[model samples]
Target: MTRVDDPATTSPEQARAAFRAGTVAPTSGWAPGFTQTNLIAVPRDWAYDVLLFCQRNPRPCPVLDVTDPGDTSTVLAPGADLSRDLPRYRVWRHGELAEEVEDVRGLWQENLVAFSIGCSFTFETGLRAAGVPLRHLEQGRNVPMYVTNRRCRPAGRLHGPLVVSMRPIPAGLVGEAVAISGAMPAVHGAPVHVGDPGELGIVDLGRPDFGEPVEADPGDVPVFWACGVTPQAALMASKPPFAITHSPGHMFITDRADSEYRVPVQRNE
Candidate 1:
């Protein structure tokens, strides 16, 4: 694990700098107030399908920004190299994971286009402020993500199951967690399911398809949110010729604030 001074005090630039220097770890609590995103890059020929996939399944794949073909720079983090700044990356060839690396500068193709998708981690700051405890952060583990039996609406050439990140919210605070996250639609706003992992085809909470398993306290209820990592399932199923993505829990920290994507929620006084 790469250590930082403090998550709340760290800046997006600092986090990216550490990642660029080859620091590798889940970015859950890093740079708390800034927005973090999932990176997915595919050849220009397949960019449209990815875009359409995100459009049809906005809850799980909310797009923050899209880069032009061969561009490593995203408006989300100006001057940050998408090919190198994320802590870890997954390289895909013909739909199979070819390799995992700290940098993708060498594998980046001239026709590749990248998409930055909103992450649930971006709204975590708000949940914490509202007094909801984030078990994954508290436990120093990556948020547990599961691939469900639920299938996503297919795009032109992409199709896959819905993926979700689980958080164990106190039974009494499930509504609060929902309200807080629901207000931020761009960052996978709201819980997709609560209480029963079995309904989602998850037989074991202790094992996750991606990321580490989290410990839920006795009174805590499992709340699931639409995850940005949903795109990886598409990659695995659709099997594009070549692609790159941030490793499940490793994200690209952006310069934007969490507030930019938040919509004010009307609460009864």
Candidate 2:
């Protein structure tokens, strides 16, 4: 793993600088108070379908921002170049992963539109802050993600099964974790399932469809969150002609604050 300054205390600009300087590492724990995101870039012809698909499945695909067709900048991180901002990028051809590279600058196309989706990693900071343990983080591993039997409402030609990320939370903190994360709908908002991987078609907690895996300790409850990777899974099934996405766990760190997506209370209260 490429080591830089601790991300939890790094400013968003500094964190992004590391990514841009060729520091390829998981974005989680970096810039804790800021938002990190999953990315998907599709051709102009397929943009509408993907955008609508995100709209239809808001929980797993909460869109934080969409770049105008062919535009290289996004409102989420103004002045940053989308094609090279992320530490790693995955190129897909007809829905199949074809290449993995540190930068997408070589494949940049004028007809492509990029969609930035809310990542559950953004809520992890709040969970940790609230005293909820995240085993994956403590172990320096990627949170495990699994594909469930659940189906997302289809949109045009874009459709597929849902994907979720798992974090082993202390059984006692499950309620506190839910209450803390549930308020941030834009950051994948709360746990979808609190226990039993079998219920989600995840037969083995030691093996994950994506990312590193962590076992639920003796008294820890396995908690799942709707994941931004859901779109990548859909792309793998739907077979769009051409697409690009951030490599799982390698996210786009944004200038936006994590608090920006939280449920707000009345000013009078």
Q: How far is candidate 2 from the true structure (C-alpha RMSD, Å)?
A: 2.2
lDDT of 1: 0.93
Best by TM-score: 1
Q: Model 2: which ten-residue window has the lowest total lDDT? A: 260-269
Q: TM-scores of all models?
A: 0.98, 0.96
As a TM-score, model 2 comes out at: 0.96
Query: What TM-score quantifies how close candidate 1 is to the native fold?
Result: 0.98
Local error of candidate 2 at 90, Å?
0.6
Task: Give the winner by lDDT.
Answer: 1
Q: Indicate the residue-level lDDT of 223 in model 1.
A: 94
Residues 1-269 of candidate 2 have per-residue lDDT tens digits of 33575777888778778888888888888888888899999999999999899999999999989888889898888889889889899999998899999888879899999999999889888888888888888888887889999999999999999999998888899988888889899989877898898999889988899999886678998889999999999998999889999999999999999999989632443
lDDT of each: 0.93, 0.89
Query: Which 10 consecutive residues of model 1 have the lowest summed lDDT?
Result: 1-10
